[model samples]
Target: MTDLRDVTLRDGLQLTGKPLPTARKVAVVRELLDAGVPSVEIGSMARPDLVPPLADTLDLIRALDPDELARCWVWVATPRHVERAAEAGAVNFQYCLSASDAHNRANIGRSTEDSLAAMPRAVAAASAAGGRIQLCIATSFTCPFEGAVPEERVLAIARDPRAEGARDIVLCDTLGQAVPTQVTSLVARVAAEMPPRRIVYHGHDTWGLGVANTLAALAAGASEVDGALGGLGGCPFAPGASGNASTEDLLFALRPSWLTPSSFARIVRLSGALLDELGEPNRSRAAQGARTSATAFPWALGAEVSCR
Candidate 1:
């Protein structure tokens, strides 16, 4: 079975101009757990001025129920962030590195090599603090500033995370410019170096290839995928970037296999409600189309439509 990680609370809120209230974030976490999601990327411990939405990362982590807290993951941009997350009871930590130096400089105010050099220390600190690490190689396919990223460059940086005890390595299409063929080839190359089961695909829908690339990654042997509810995420520092692949759409695509039709529908409803509450537009095309269809022909149906 493929594992899905919901990143709605972290990456989803990273670029939103307004911050989500602590109560609403806690509510969303509970709803996601109830929907049967195995893992959730709860929040990030980045600079408060850089990513204002996550200023209350510690409080949010504290608000989670004991059981949910055990399953939550937080983003760590530095060793300090990892230490803070560990102190706040987060056991799973995600570290992101850009494949392109130019993009990395723009995003993190450092070169790609600098970020790679810092990983061992951060990973070691997290490990010492009893945290499981997941490393994300961002702009793995194409970089907004530098364009296409070479396969060798990605593989080289990926080695650092694996060497530093990262349990999972996620290949991210940070600018959403990847296609199926590229995803397949890159995933195949990485899978040759590491266990395919440890590979995760994190994609954006900017070019409308997020789902396609994810499917390609799975076909190429990746065992896990990441998505945000209602397609609500983007890298504010990555130019032309858009939301991550929508969880509702991905569940619909994986229907009858990893997700039941009823569960998929439930997630869709919950996502719509959550996005509405946040005063943000639901970026899921599948959800938007469904709402449009229902509105356009209000009297067409006699009973509830079953996804099954």
Candidate 2:
């Protein structure tokens, strides 16, 4: 079975244009963990002025138990973020950097080379603080302004990060432009150099291929897969970009083999409820179909119509 890691708090809040208060964040974190999500990316250490929702990340960490904090990972985009996370008692850190030149310049005010050069320092700092670090290689599939990232560029970045003491690396399809074949090929190639456990897949569903590409990654020997709870998040660069593959949707698609049907359906139900409360749309096909199915609520259908 592939390990699923929820990125709801980090990726979900990106470009949301709204701030999630501390109380709401705490509640959401508690709810996600209680749902048996296994792992949840709970927050980011990026600039608070930028990601205001996570302004209380330190407080959120303080409120969580050490054991609970161990299960919930957070992002650290720079050494400063790493220091802040360590102070907040986060155990696992995913240090992120954009691979696309345009994104690197715009998002972090640096070149891809500069970000790469700084990665070792970030990893070293996290290590010194006794935190596990994963270098997240963003925009592995496509870049909005650049478009069509070459395989060589991605492989080079992966090699450098791997050499920099990064225990794990994630290939992020930030723009959701990855095809199944490409996902399979890239994961397979990366796995050849590193252990399968060291590679993670972060795919988006922009073209309706998130779950398909995830299956491809697993087939290609990827051990970890990243997703969000209810298909939250959008690419700021790519217009109309959707969220990561919903955890519920991924489980549903992986069902009858990798996941039990009942277990998968339970998570889907919870995810649907969370989305409803957030006033967000349910983007899972299976979820929408189930909601509309006659068996969902016999009384509602009957109450609305008569067989006459």
Candidate 3:
């Protein structure tokens, strides 16, 4: 089965300027797990001062009952963040570092080289703390300031982290500039460089090719994928970009290949309900279908899964 990780809490809300309340966040997590998502990227470790929207991140973590998502896994970033997450009972961790020089400076106030230099130390810290590390190579695709990132640069980043004992590595399509051919080719290259099980695709939907790129990566042998709940994320640091691939849309599109329609549709309904409660309009294809026709309420079963 394909592994799916939802990123609505972390990436989804970064641009909305509204922090989801702890209760609402917890409810969404429970709903996602019930919908059968194996994992969720709930928040980030960036300074709460910089992202007041996620200021309650630590508090949310502190109050999270392990049993609420017993079947699901949640992840966060940074060594200090991981420590705090551990205190709050998070079972998984995602350590993000930028690969694009321009984005690194803009997002983390560090250069690519500086970020790479810190990887070994970050990896060591997380490992020492006894949590699994999923290193996120952000801006693996084209960058806004510096377009068309070289494949070799991304490969080097992935290889270095893997060499440092990172068990999981995600290639982030930060600006959603990646095409299917690029995604497939990159996945093949990364797979050849590292263990196949360790690679994942984290795509954005800016150009409306999120699902297409995801299929390309999967077709090229990627076992895991990352997306948000309802097409709900945009880079707060990266200017004029769009959201991550919607969890509901991604699942609905991938149903035939990965999950049964009944399973995918259930996830859509739960995700839609949470989105409604959050005061955000649904951007999911399944949700749109439901609005248009009751027959499409369970759209995943018959919806076209073709890559655009």
Task: State which candidate has the highest TM-score.
Answer: 1
> Rank order by TM-score, top first?
1, 3, 2
lDDT (Cα, tens digit) per residue for candidate 1, span 219-254: 897888889988998988887898999887776565
Estimate TM-scores for all models.
Answer: 0.90, 0.87, 0.88
Better of 1 and 2 by TM-score: 1
Tens digits of per-residue lDDT, candidate 3, 25-127, equal: 7777776766667777777667777776666766666566676433333444345666676666665667777777988888877787776676666666666
Please count the clashing residue pairs in each candidate, in the order shown: 0, 0, 0
lDDT of 2 at 265: 53
lDDT against the true structure, each candidate: 0.81, 0.75, 0.74
Worst 10 residues of 3 by lDDT: 69-78
Model 2 / residue 266 / CA error / Å: 4.8
After aligning candidate 1 to the native by TM-score, how far in Å is the CA of 253 from where it should be? 0.7
- The pairs that clash in candidate 2 are none
Residue 190, model 1, lDDT: 86
RMSD of 3: 3.1
TM-score of 1: 0.90
